[model samples]
Target: MKKVTWKIQYDSTPLIHRHCKKCGKKTRFKSSDQFRINAQRQYLDIWLIYKCTKCNTTWNATIFSRISPQALTSEQLNQFQENDQALAKNYAFDFDLLRKNGAEYELPAFSIVGDDIGTGESAEVKLISEYILPIKVSTLLRKKLHLSQKSFRELVENGRIKDASGQNLLKSKLNGETTIIFLP
Candidate 1:
């Protein structure tokens, strides 16, 4: 099999150093994925729980407010009921949910690994999100590929490589595969 792709996996752990209302300072919250479920008639209320790193104060990121039990799939219910970290990681990166609760969030730290699949002049870098989202990749490429800012800018200006969206790949949000081509 010819290996023609490089895979980059992002870290899903949140970097949302939010301000704890109780602690009165900015603190990082850790997601427990352990939900507090309450049964109300035919509705199920769910909340993804978190804790303040500094003061240990708990905060609830509501997932469902009296949602019908049938609304969630069997797998989703299992994931929530069993405190699945992967599911929680997805929720932790939910910008809408985070903003709805008036919580400040920062981008998570990412670790990028390039998998060499083929020896060729052209290479495809597949960016996979651990949190099921798109993330900016210019900084990542600079750090991983060791390209200076000026050099990166030149590449974008010269149209050497396009991003996932098929445009100049400067600071583009990467969620899928991108092709990097070497020019003669």
Candidate 2:
């Protein structure tokens, strides 16, 4: 079978959802791409900063709390202190960390990077993601293939499109990597 690969490319960091005391309601917060560090004698506390999109209020997402400065190497600590963009991006995309901080997050904008499948082509397509997002498999396929709900449903029902591992294509959430097969 012919093989194709698609990579998920996020355009922005996730927007955090939580109550903004200043706004008096839940609001989306965008990452400020900055880190705040506090030194308390022998311990250090670190956080990634976020701002309310609607009100510009600030919220700090805890990265490390009351941890010893020695816990991280000098290079790591320097990166945090300098507000490294890549390091900030890594923490900003951490869904589990966001949930642990009592905040919900919306997935950022993304584009699928790959060539489109030809008509009636039989192929194995691998979908890859750098981050474990909550996007659904069906949504990705339908969006990338420009298929309507009815057309996508028909293809799935008729077995013209299916998960390589037998996952329910309509209900499976994309996590890391997934393979789908197209049959002529």
Candidate 3:
């Protein structure tokens, strides 16, 4: 069987959703790509800053709260103090941290990077993502293959497309990596 691999490439960081006191409603917040550090004697606190897209209000997402400065290496501490872009990006994409802060997030725009399979070709396809995302498998497949809902549904129902484990692909969400098989 032919093999193909697809990688999901995100275009930007996700926007966070939470109540904005200034806006008096829930609003989307975009990351400012900056970090704020506070040192209190022996402890240090770190936060990633975000701004309300609609009102420009600021919110700080906690990274480390009242932790010892010695807990992190000098390089790590310096990265946080200097607002490293990569470090900031890692924190910005952390959905668990966002959920813990009572906030929701929208997924960033993404493109599937892979070669296309021709009609009636048997193939094993692997889908991979760098981050754990809550994207629907059906949506990704349809977008990459340029298939309509009806066409995609028909293919699934007729056993042309299926997950490697035979899970219902239509109802499955992609977390990190998934394998699918296309029957000729």
What do the candidate models score in CA lDDT, each in turn?
Answer: 0.69, 0.95, 0.92
Task: For each candidate, give its TM-score against the true structure.
Answer: 0.80, 0.89, 0.86
lDDT of 1 by residue, 134-153 (tens): 55667666766677989878
The sequence of per-residue lDDT tens digits that candidate 3 reaches over residues 5-46 is: 999999999999889999999999999999999999889889
Model 1, runs deviating above 4 Å: 1-4, 10-12, 116-120, 132-134
Clashes of 3: 0
Q: Tell me the lDDT of candidate 3.
A: 0.92
- Predicted model with the maximum TM-score: 2
Model 2 clash count equals 0
Model 2, range 1-184, lDDT digits (tens) per residue?
8899999999999999989999999999999999999999999999999999998999999999999988999999999999999999999999989998999999899999997888698999999998888778999999899999899999999999999999999999998999999998
Worst 10 residues of 3 by lDDT: 129-138
Model 1 global lDDT (CA atoms, 0 to 1): 0.69
Model 1: per-residue Cα lDDT at residue 77: 88
